[model samples]
Target: MIRPDDETKPFVGRWNSLIRILLVESSVKHVARAAMDYANLYDGTSCHPSNERLARETGYNERTVRKAWAAMRGMGLAERVSHGVAHRRLSDEYQLVIPESWQSLPVLGPSGAKFTCVHCEKAFNPTGNCKVHPDGRVTFDLIPMVFCPEPRQRKGREEPWCATEWDGQRRASGETPWSQLGQERWKVFHLARGEEW
Candidate 1:
């Protein structure tokens, strides 16, 4: 379901190597690069020419796209999204999915009680992953999301998330990069652990 404008419009006439693939390359990396060029932007979300869509658009063997996509995923150039069981259409191909800053997570201070997430200012009580996408998709906030509803203070003194400072902030010691916190880890940190380190 990658829209034509998805890549073409954003990068705008810069197909570069991919255009070459669209013309005369079939090497996994090259064709995959072509497919990736379809994404054109790395907004921390998966975007691209779905192998199926690419097969339709470029007439390249799905396997070529699949291999290149696999390499891209290995190279950290793209992300496979969660499409539930329905996402199984391509056992080898991975779709680009974005990791949005919404989900279950708690806000902790240097010490003390944690606060809840109130996205768009709706009073969302404790729930799995803390984020409730109206689309039934769950998301978790990353790094307190700058939307942390409360800041750590003395006992019973959680301040607003908007007031927290993020200077020099980093993934907890020995913690995985934020992007690597996939569904399970993300769920635990934000939903289960309530945004704790």
Candidate 2:
């Protein structure tokens, strides 16, 4: 299992805030409990806990857990065991996944939101840098972020969540975003205007 450590600490703090709070709300707490049950599947050996059993453990009504499970499925957080009969749930294979919207800038620079990567597993600092062409046109490089489901940093405390390196291929020569990232594994994050961001 991917134990939540310093590498995953930072991003989880920033990105998980809303989801954490939301997951604990009204119907959502059931969803959270179910997610935890699903996560238990990969704990040590494997868990195929039934949704029914999960409800019993979490104090949620069976029907309510079912509904919450469906909602979690839509959010890309949980999946059914087979066609759908079992209470056993499936978890994301990669375990960490960041959405594009979270890694993006709505309007180029400052107007954009900042996020940490689930894959790269780090939070970009000061300001999240542009992952695109520094030539002015905003490039959409894959920014490092988090899934925020594991043990992570608390709000008042933060750790590293920047992309030091990526697992995939390097970009073609002269490709700004890829090369810029290559300039240093620890990248100098900048904005669309190429200033400190």
Global lDDT of each candidate: 0.39, 0.37
- Model number with the top TM-score: 2
For model 1, the superposed segments whose C-alpha errors exceed 4 Å read 1-26, 37-48, 84-197
For model 2, residues 112-175, the per-residue Cα lDDT tens digits are 3443443343443222222223342333232322222233678998654233222222333333
Candidate 2: list runs displaced more than 4 Å.
1-7, 10-19, 23-25, 37-47, 84-197
Give the TM-scores of the predictions, in the order they appear. Answer: 0.28, 0.33
Q: How many clashes does the backbone of model 2 have?
A: 15
Judged by whole-model lDDT over C-alpha atoms, candidate 2 comes out at: 0.37
Error of 1 at 9 (Å): 15
TM-score result, candidate 1: 0.28
The digit string of per-residue lDDT tens for model 1 on 1-197 reads 22222444343232232222121223543554455555535432345345666666666677766655554444333466643243555333344332121112122222223434423232333321223344433234554432344535778676544323222132434545445646544443344223332
Which one is best on lDDT?
1
